[model samples]
Target: MEGPAGEKVPSDNQVKTFERTATGLVREISAFRTLVLDLMFTSPVFMFVFAILGIGIFVGADMVVSTLLALLIGFTTAGMYALLSIAYPRSGGDYIFISRILSPPLGFMVNFVFTIVNISVIGTEAVWVSTMALGPMFSGLGAIMNSSSLASYASVFSQPVYIFIIGAVVMLVFTSVMFFGTGPTFKIKSVLFFVAVFSVIVYIAAIGLTSTSAMISNFNHLSSTSYQQYSGIVTSNGLPEKFEVVPTL
Candidate 1:
């Protein structure tokens, strides 16, 4: 019999060949696709600020060391997830594994907290992406065109009404896609995966090409003497830069 997502059931003798197996999920996703999804989950677009400015700009020459440490932690966490996924082979992730291995009550508590956090982060992240990523990107394009009026026009994305509307639309689109099924969701994610990889490469190349002297000069101007002021600047800029500093591109 065929399961959801077109996963076919193996015969009794066929199943005996493997040490362990699960029949619920479709085996449509390939290893490369899994790698891409894992990459997106771990090193998301939001992490660009940390990888670029946090390590390259602030930490300076120790960027490689910092990156290696982060990779070690990330891989260790990934390994655990892999093991759990193998053992459980279900959709619910931590909820399934915890509920099955530990206790249902404990698993419910854990997933409940996680669900709340995720719901909260959705709106916040949407607003952030609108104000920080899109707004600045358009504003920079306006600058290239030498139009202050265009820059001001683009800044509308930061407004409460605009942010709310755009965020709602994005959320609706995402929700619809997810409701459709795993196959469609996986297809969309695969496209995003390539884009993510390309963006990462570009970010790294940009940093690598920049002279250390220039970065140091920029850092000196951008650095704050106090933590409070520094945090304020970072929050205002959305990706952590001096409050007065403006992007030329």
Candidate 2:
């Protein structure tokens, strides 16, 4: 298309360049799906659930008040996520949101804080994973070597040194992976994502079935004893005045 004043208009080449850029963006977005799934699988949800269960067990409440507290906190966190998404609706996340809400200086400061927190979280995760990986090896070392003299000296020297070495190794590996860029990182993460999901499903199924079976056996024994005591066949300690039936799903 040309203007009537003999001036050259935007040509097909310019249009083609814009289209190519758009196509590249679409391809990148499509490729990111696996990375997103990987993140979802390795998320904090599992740790959060385990923490809540541990708290409930340790608190020893008949009705588990910690469960309610967890629910409330979860709801509030979800609401915050929703609010942030609605407000920003962009890729850069809180940095963009803060910039929109306040001055650039404030936004940069908030972004710096977010970066620090994110790095700290990454460091913590690396430490936790290293602990899980090396705990068995350290325990084995302790068992083979008596703790009286040699083992004690070994433990004292090895603990901090091993931890430091592990931390350094983890950091180096992660840094190398990151430096390689998103493509290779995403590929490895995709495999880890599937592994994490499969592990969780297997763990949950095993624990759930075992717990249910144990509960059913205990319930049957309790019911039989209650029946015997009610019929005046034998004396039972702490018999309920009235039997209450609880439904299990």
Check candidate 1 and list the clashing pairs. Answer: none
Where model 2 places Cα greater than 4 Å from the true spot, the runs are 1-27, 31-42, 45-58, 61-72, 79-91, 136-158, 212-249
**Pairing residues by index, what is the TM-score of model 1?**
0.66
Give one digit per residue, the lDDT tens place, for model 1 in 1-249.
777789887766664321225565545677777777777766567566555565435522344456576777889877888887776554537777787778889999999999999899888777876887789887877756767786886779978899998899888888899888878888898998889788978987988998977766655554434455654766666544432212210
Root-mean-square deviation of every model: 9.2, 11.0
TM-scores for every candidate against the unseen true structure = 0.66, 0.55
Stretches of candidate 1 exceeding 4 Å from the true structure = 1-28, 51-67, 89-92, 212-249
Q: How well is each residue in 191-238 modelled by candidate 2, as lDDT tens digits?
A: 767777787787568667787557556545534354334535422433
In candidate 2, where is summed lDDT lowest over 10 consecutive residues? 240-249
